[model samples]
Target: MTNLYTGCPKMKEMDGRAVLILFIMLTLVKTEGLVSVTTGSDYVVTRVGENQTISLDVSRAGGEFRVSFNDSTEYLFHKFNNSDLKRVNNNRTLYRDRYRVRGNITSSVFRLTLYNVTTEDAGIYECQKFEGNQRVPGCKQLLIVARNPSQPNITGPASAVSGGSVTLTCSSSSRSLPPDHPPLTMNYTWKRNSEEIQGGGDVSVDGPNLTMKDISREKAGNYTCQAKEEELKSDWSARHVLDVQYGPNTVHFNETHDKVTATEGDPLTVRCSADCNPACTVTWLDTSRQKVTSGQREAVLSIPAVNRSLSDLYTCHVNNTHGNKSRNLKLDIQYGPYTVQFNEIDDKVTATEGDPLTVTCSADCNPTCTVTWWDTYKQRVTSGHREAVLSIPAVNRSLSDLYTCHVNNTHGNKSRNLKLDIQYPPSVKTFSDISINNITRKVDSVSFLCVVDGNPKPSVYLRHDLTNRTYPMTCETLSKSIYTSHQYYECTHTNENFDVFLHGAYSCRAENTVGHVDSRAVVVTVPSK
Candidate 1:
């Protein structure tokens, strides 16, 4: 009879009953091969320094089952059987006290517990009935993923100047792992004020290094870093506060108004301030570039009894550790209506009688001076501020009087006089009679008289038509008047002197710088002697 066991050729000569017993034993071994192993899921993940249990279920199993763990390389690390549960292979002693199997061999469910898991314990685990050292193909694979994450420590400058660059390095303490275990790769993430920081713009990241370019006050905040390995994440690291220092951005008066005005002899105070980090040193400078020592961040420029000399540009220089900045403050000091003055070369004005006259008055004052033109009678002719013009059209002697420009302000008042001189052409008013009693006889004395009016006394003369001769004459001015009386010419016939020479048409002429005027002719005739 042929042997029922294929590998037992020597048993071919044995008894058939013995062959039947051997076949029964082989059949029992095949029946036990139907054992199926399963787990809760296909994958298992656990963090380092934590405990995790992988539950296994075996279906229809009636024999001793062997459980073993294999890495991604299919290398066995641990094994458990009905008789004993222990680490095996190269990691046997490495994970000696870190792993345990809980459950009786007769139970349908068994658990593989990992305590204080490490990176080296991550791999696939197989549980199946052992068939004489052969692993069953139906065994389930439990992929265990062990993770070790670390809290990242951020290292960089706590303070940075605005517009500068800074780099923060996220570092972590080395993780402890089993001997001969693969190295753990870690990833880093950055956060600011609890918000995730994205790469781009002024911020960029490379692995564990984070760079911030062109930092500003807006970039100042609390920053933190976290380190991750596989699916395990660590807690956020301690916050690193960034302080951005800068200059005094804007400087101006603390008051609402930027410019201030003060009257002469009045006390004035100007307060200046600036916006800056790390506090700014503020100093006030006068127009002369002299520093006004004061406190930092604010400077009070005080002026006691401000005058025109005190009016100038005041600078508020603000300086800090970051940079420097300055602002200009204008100080206006108002003063008098200084003595009313004329822009003309001289205050005395001369114009023709029929011409127009304009007299402008200008004054120096802080709040602008009020100017008024007053005549000798103290009557207001015109009023204006700073400057005023008194215009007289076709001015005559009546308008030619002592005119004064009065300038006044809150500070003081002043007056300036302007004398107007009016000039006109000479005029012949009247001519005295040259005939005696409307009749002239031979040897009778004859004379001619003329009256003239002009701005200045004019020269009077008489012209004889028949004789074609002119006789210069003398004049007598009327008191406080522009008129004058003069004897123009005289002709007398005495003895051998004939009256024929004196008998002629005579006229009077008055001449001056302006012009000359001639009077109507009066004939000097001698009756028949």
Candidate 2:
């Protein structure tokens, strides 16, 4: 303490500036000697804008104290001592804003606390003890390390098309440390959406630069980076958003089961949309391939009334300048039966009797119409299906009738007629019984008649057994019945014996294109032979 005023003028006589110079010079000389002779060294780490309380070991140092801060240079940052520390202090404003020391003036256990530490504060610190204004030999060597780097920034393409490549980089200053210690060393780590990311096939990392290949929409998110140096680290960088521009990925329909359904004479509506980046356009096409809506993100198709003709395919197309896609939508328009008619374009179906017969009835409708076959008597005889099949294993003329094909839906109904015409061979019937006839000499001029029935009147004939031939062609169609034919064989000559009479055997034959039939034979005999 005597050395501070040994050669200096009285405190009131000297200029304040000169007094400060002398004090700082004296502190520097003492600190220089203490650092060169001190063998113990300590360390401290702090972040910028943060306060650090270094627990310096001043227990070895006693009495008055001298604290000096340095950056390993010839000059010293000056000092802090017990007396005149704040009392009558001048030009020591650096101590008030950046540092504060607290302890009893006579105590050796003192603490140093740095306020709002900055990058420039990283340096060496020296502490020397004194008693009776002479050096005590106790000393300490402290190293302060400060880390403050510029806020990390990420630069890269803000947006890109799918399947394209992308590159990004994180940058910050590395000279955050002071001159006392080595330059600040930093390593970079990247994260996306707050989750750490590694480098591999899809992503490549080299130092601070990160690259991504074949980028897709699924890989888009917010990215950030951090600068790290050993245990010290800087705050995370500002978020850099990566948006991948792409065309419409897929199309979806608002309708259920991807289909539109409506009953006959009812309204219908269909809607479609797509997923894309820049809001894609949509187009709705009808069954005729004509656009119903175009150049919109969403589209709708409306129909006032629905029918079988309106049941068809529709298309929903979504597109952008990059590409386009289309999906087909089916409109199942339901309705009652229509265009009802029989098979072969004829209302009548002609078939031979005793042969299999089949008749079909159909109509155009959506959801397939419920069909039934009804006979002329209004009897439902056929199974229900899209089309009616009236099947008969063996058909006969008795089964011929007019059949109706009836179809019905919740919306409407319709009916069609089909005539079943069954044709058969001629059927013959004889009127008189000649098998028991006793034709004697008195029974002259006896007659036989026959009738034949068929679709087309068959030609009728009479035959005699004795001649074994159709000798008499006397059968003719009846005047009263157009389908009937008659035959008469008169007994021209009476005979005494069964063998000598014309009544020995008589028969009738009826024939048409379909087939032929023969009637029962008649025989005559004499009594009391």
Candidate 3:
């Protein structure tokens, strides 16, 4: 039966069967593979001060395959898996496993946005493809970086007036953010020394300036400007120095008065003053320039009357917390132009003719002055005399003259006239005595005498040769006598009658309050019995 049927329908059945086989072959997947993934660009460049952009593309085809963008980030790409996709493996799920229509092809692409991109982003990025525990492709690398920002410049004043405002400006030549990501937010910190300053609401972001109002002395110091973005902080700008100054508060002098001489019944005034801020203290100084009592604030110092004894240097001192100043003035007093007493004169005098005679006229006055003497002949004689006499070789009847004497001092000058006469007496007598009394011996009593007769009586004394002891002689006037010797202990006097010290010499000296006389050394020895 089977043989007969196969022969009868061969042509018709063969054509139908061939058509069905062709349809089945057209619907079936012939091969399983993947084409390489690609990006919009293979290379990327960026500067430190600027930003950049990049896009990723993955165009490939296969049966039941899954695609993923393995970014450097652990979370990988923000996923966009088609809802109809199923799990190909534990690590990758089937996305677009089966297309709805036969021969219909499609591709998947991803966009990555980075903010504040830096050199750290320069590395490899994986672009992987998988199908049911199989790998079709691998990841690729993308580079990113930033160009260095320009240095900042700062402008400001060294010092601002007190209670005035000061402004500091910090700017950069090229200021920008990277374009690969959104614009970065920048941070600014204003500082003095190392301390950050607190700005009022007056801060402005765009200008990066710090404006301080009502500046005071405390507001002086160094300043710095800093700009920061992400993890990068910019360098500080150059430093600035400030100073403030002012003055003229006080004045003073070392002295107050300036008069050298003032007569009695005259007026006087002195000044002691100083200039200073916050008012200076005024004080008077004595000749020593030391602060003295009695100082008043009178534009001019006035003394009602002056006397002869007020002579000294007066000083005015001005002082303040800051410093001291001083001024000096000299004051002198003067008085008296009169004389009080006259000179004394002897009533009689003896002189030879044409002999040189001398007389003195003394007077007391405000100032010492000169005196003069004259003769009755009106001829000027030797000046300065209380007693003046005229003489001739032998008193001629013409040997007469009225002598005039004058005395003067700073007080006033005066003159007086007087007559002089001459007389003579027997020759004045004086007595002499033996000068030597050198004999040395122990004596119970001794005798010596000196006698003289003149206009005045003269006294005598007895001195010991062995000892420098002097004894006043008391006896009837013009009498000579002997005196007994007495021993004294603890007396400064040493006697030659006593042995000399082992190594010392002994002598005798005699003296009156007016004159001295000494005797030669006298050696004495004891008789051994």
Candidate 4:
């Protein structure tokens, strides 16, 4: 049997017989895992400062035993026939103060404990058992792991812009071991705000490095890293806060009332704000995109008194290094007509009795004003937009009065007045259904009636059509109509001897300074001759 202690090991030969032995079992301290086995030796694994105890099944042991390290010739521990442990100062292997022997030969049980195990103490440890002249082969290697890794440090910039890329690296180390052994394999883990980071998409983890592309503001936070070597964990690295500079977002407004509409001359005030890192800049823009008010993160716009011109358009803009944002605000003013007047036509209009006339009024107002043309009696003549039109296809003398062009809205109202005068040449119209002067010859006296219409009470007279332009009969006004230009008049021509000489055509003529028009000739005839 060869012991773990190395002073140049010497293997004892089996006397022409092959021995089947797999009895030596390795046990580690605190950590649980499978022990690797190779040809002759089993392996035990543990960390520094932990005790390593290798167990031996002594059911087949001889009463004599010896423990060794790294196949050494000198014994690390020795016992003979249930006696006390032997001194281990043979200039080889582990010292006596570090290892201890326990169990009794009669009990057929044995084990060894290597105390204060360090990286320097890593080697193959084994116990040899002798049964009379025969030897028992029992050996195993004890591997002492170095201490946990040092605290890691993450390296990267303190801040980054949104939509850009970011790369961070972390590094850690621990105590070294002899060149004869393989170094411990290390694994890295990342955390953000104390939550484990699972890499995918734009974010990726390659060993100790964390890489991210097209970063957003939401991904900004404290980041840390930890190192793990063979079930041992290192402390988390210091927190590295990543500040993301981004444009404005999540806009809001503050107003006492709904700004969609308001009365003219009303006081108005509105404020705009948004969320951003590094405090975004804010400004108020006009409909033309001209900057009006500038501020940081928030902006205020005020109007002491609103007017129709200031309605309709307002915008808020915010921006930073990453991008910009804009939003439109609604404002409408309700106001009465202000610029109301006749278009080309004046307030006072004049037209001939038979002439066509058209009068228009124009008005400007907010909230779209409605225009109405009212007559003297307050009757609605026409209605439309502020461009109200009043048309008289053919004007008469009666169409001479004041007309109103009214423009109104929900806020208030406005009106304009226009007076119209109509003039014409007088014309006589026969009254009493007598369009023509007709009389019987037997009738001693004949009377004719006619209606005269004129603007200035024209002179009316009965004329004999054949008597050299002479008004031979009397004509007078009987009654003058109060509502119209109807003047009732009667004209008579009488003769005691009714003859053909005096029976010439008689007519009525109405003449004014404008012109004159005559009626048909009167007739006299014998009845039933």
Candidate 5:
């Protein structure tokens, strides 16, 4: 039939056409999905030695679609699919198009976890579908980068006193990748003036605090702590300076270079030596407690004329930048002992013969004070007692002698002269005619009277020959009295050294501090007619 064109060659062409149609139908079934992948266009940044994630979207891919990584050899990652892709007619072989995904791993997540990450893992990722010689799109790019930790803050003194301890600390914080790409942990080291302190036995590190113990002047300097992380380190923190101080040393005193004794006019030297940051100043003290700034390390004190009054206590005071110190010294000046003066109020003293005598004895000496005296008889006299005397009885003349007074003190010794003279005279008066004078008859009962006058009052006494017993016939009273009726009545006179009788043999006595005297004996005998 033109007849329904049944030629063999023609038939062959018809069969090829039908097969092409069937192939097209099968492609239609598998192409139902919208296969796609998403990622940022810029490379993702990750700190050095940190893990980073690279993602791909397989949502549009058919159920049979799977993923493979581009960097599986150097680093690898797992891919998860959440899309619900299916065959068009439930025929497993219906789809002729195939799709897949690959990660452009630069800082590969797996390698970052395994090996220390360098700056290399960053690139683009892709999701592709093939339709018989035709392919689809992919995600853009991922970037990996290295970042440093921030600088740390430090706190504490830069300089500390000698023999003291100090603490140093370092801390830092950084913001970077996710948990999978945790920042690198770091270690810190301390330095003195930017120089490493390795092998320094005094330095010790514990956690965040660093300690330097018993610092000295040599330890004074600037200090810093540096933090280091994998492939990256932060700048050093601010520096702190340490200063140590100590007191003056090597103390010395200069005074009396040698031990010796000197008199009033002597020179003295005082010098103090010490090591100080600023040099030292010295001061001197005088006898009157006056202070003189030496302005130098030493001082000289000279006395033009040395004397006992110049003796005093001296001291040296030293002041330095660090502190002050001092010492004391004593100066002794010698002189002689001398007495001031001595004298007595009276030239002569009259007293009873048996009475005690007192005299003043005073003297002076450089180191001691004393006094001594002597009487006219050259006898050592007692001191401090003022009176001296001797007595005489029945002396009708005057007597004189020499006495002495003395004074002594620290200065020197001195003496004074004194003279004592005694005056005594006899007087007489008579009453009654017994034998017409000094005689009376035995048992006659004759009356007799006697009187005497003298500078000192007088007394009379009578003595019996056999018994030697003496009895007072008349004694001087402050006032005169009547003795006309008395049988045994007689008068005598006394003046210091002598005593005298008035009538009929009578005895009397006189006395003074200087001497004593006794009157001559007289007898009155009665005659028997």
Candidate 6:
């Protein structure tokens, strides 16, 4: 209130403060240009052999503008001012053929395109506007990211033998990168049959090289490689197939038919096989461990004719580069009954009447023949396995005949004959019943008859005990009967004289090779005339 407007220093100070505030506002308004620049993202990712474009929005600004691209590593790829542009340092030679700038300088939006990007182009890029020597405060920062590495290639053997070793290498090419660019730093990963491969046991990995030791069939599969750098990963490489070779594990027959059967003098054969990658050599061995057939590719063993000696355990041996195996089978040969003979005390079997008789037959055979005994009438007497016997409980003249033993089997048959003889002592039934005329007169012819039975013809005679005289009797053998042969004997006295008084007792005697028998004594009566 002390006359502020009239030469007052306080008013002068307030005025000075207001002017300074206005000046500051004006300066700020002038310093901020009408141009606005914006970007959607700070970083971009791309792959090699692909084109990429970095977009920037510049709006509300008038007059010519400039945009430049640079990296934190001081690699400046491009600089454009209106229609004129220049590439800096050696970067010009690197990007002059592959880089392009699009959109007019007068447009509110501009783009920087890169053709066939490479790992060398991965870095922070700066887009700036410059008027005279002063640089605008607002600038766009572009982070160009490189794509993943190129697809890797694998080189190695396509097939390998089991227990062998192999090596595989994974490699990639980056022709799009700058010549001065450092080697790509990549992490290598391997896969087998679409599964990740871990380094252990038979598998080993060193950088891009993969080695397998003591390879087996289990390790055979499709293989591929992938390369990764930072957060980027490459596509899987082409599949490489590996084949593993091995040998057979076992040798044997196909089914349970492991035994072979054949008849003597017949052909026989056997076969065996094995599972193997490489073919195997087969050989046949006899029971004595001697080679029956030479080594051949086919698994077959053949014999022209089978014999008793050929019937044994045969061995089949199979061999290969990896290992060897063997199988054994039995061969059976069938033969007929042979060498049949009768087992008897002598050629002619002898037995007493009413005694037991037995004759046995034996033969040699493979399957043991079926022995059957038969008489001369073709009747079966006995049967057995290896031997046969014909028995008669009480032998008589009826049983004295020839016997045969027949031995038969699957092969053939054989027979043998045996003779049987029956012997008996002399036996007399009646001595007075002999056929003779009745002695009625002294001159009449009187005779006595004796009936005897024995094996051999027995000698007959009549004896007179009182006179101590013996008169031989004539005997005749009749036809053979069931029991034995009968013999008839006759003793005659033509004249009845003093002999009647001397004949106290008369007896008939029969003798043979076995023993002798005597008939009852009888008296001769003299009738009164």
Residue lDDT tens for model 1, 103-187? 4423345454566666666555655444544454545444344444567788999999999999999987534333223444567
Model 2 earns a TM-score of 0.52
TM-scores of the candidates are: 0.51, 0.52, 0.26, 0.63, 0.31, 0.55
* Angstrom error at residue 207, model 3: 15
RMSD of each: 12.5, 11.3, 27.7, 10.5, 20.4, 13.6
1-529 per-residue lDDT for model 2 (tens digits): 2212233322212112211211110111111111212122234445566666544444444323445556222222222332333312335454445544443332234344566666666665655332232333434344444445567899998887889999889997654456445444567889999999888988987877889999988878999998776445668999999988788877887745676677877877777888777678999887788888775778876777867665388898998876788888877777767678666658877777789977777877666778898876777888566788888999776663678888877767888888666667877655444333454554434455666666545666666767866634455444532221222222222222334345476676777778998888876544433
**Local error of candidate 4 at 241, Å?**
0.9
What does the lDDT come to for candidate 6?
0.62
For residues 1-529, could you state the per-residue lDDT of candidate 6 as single tens digits? 1211223222111111111000000000011111112123333344555666655454422233344444232324222322223344444566755644454323245444667666766544444333342333444443334446789999999888888999988886543233333344567899999999999988999888899999988888999999875446778899888877677677766453667777888987677777655678888888889987745454667788888866389888888787778888888788997678776465578777789877778787778899998876788877999887777788876663677778988889987767677777887877773322444444244466777776666777777767667677766555554432233333333322433354346777888897898889876664545
Show model 6 residue runs off by greater than 4 Å. Answer: 1-49, 54-98, 102-111, 116-248, 253-256, 276-281, 287-291, 294-299, 319-324, 339-348, 353-369, 375-400, 409-411, 429-513, 519-529
- Score residue 229 of candidate 3 by CA lDDT: 49
Steric clashes per prediction: 1, 1, 38, 12, 59, 2
Instruction: List ranges where model 4 is wrong by over 4 Å.
Output: 1-45, 53-87, 90-112, 115-142, 175-182, 248-259, 274-278, 426-529
Top model by lDDT, which number?
A: 4
Better model by TM-score, 1 or 3? 1
lDDT of each: 0.64, 0.61, 0.41, 0.66, 0.43, 0.62
lDDT by residue for model 5 (111-171), tens = 1111233444333233333233112233233343435667877887755655678887778
Give the C-alpha miss distance for residue 507 in model 2, angstroms: 20
TM-score of 6: 0.55
Candidate 3 at residue 165, lDDT? 74
Residue 97 miss distance in model 6 (angstroms)? 8.1
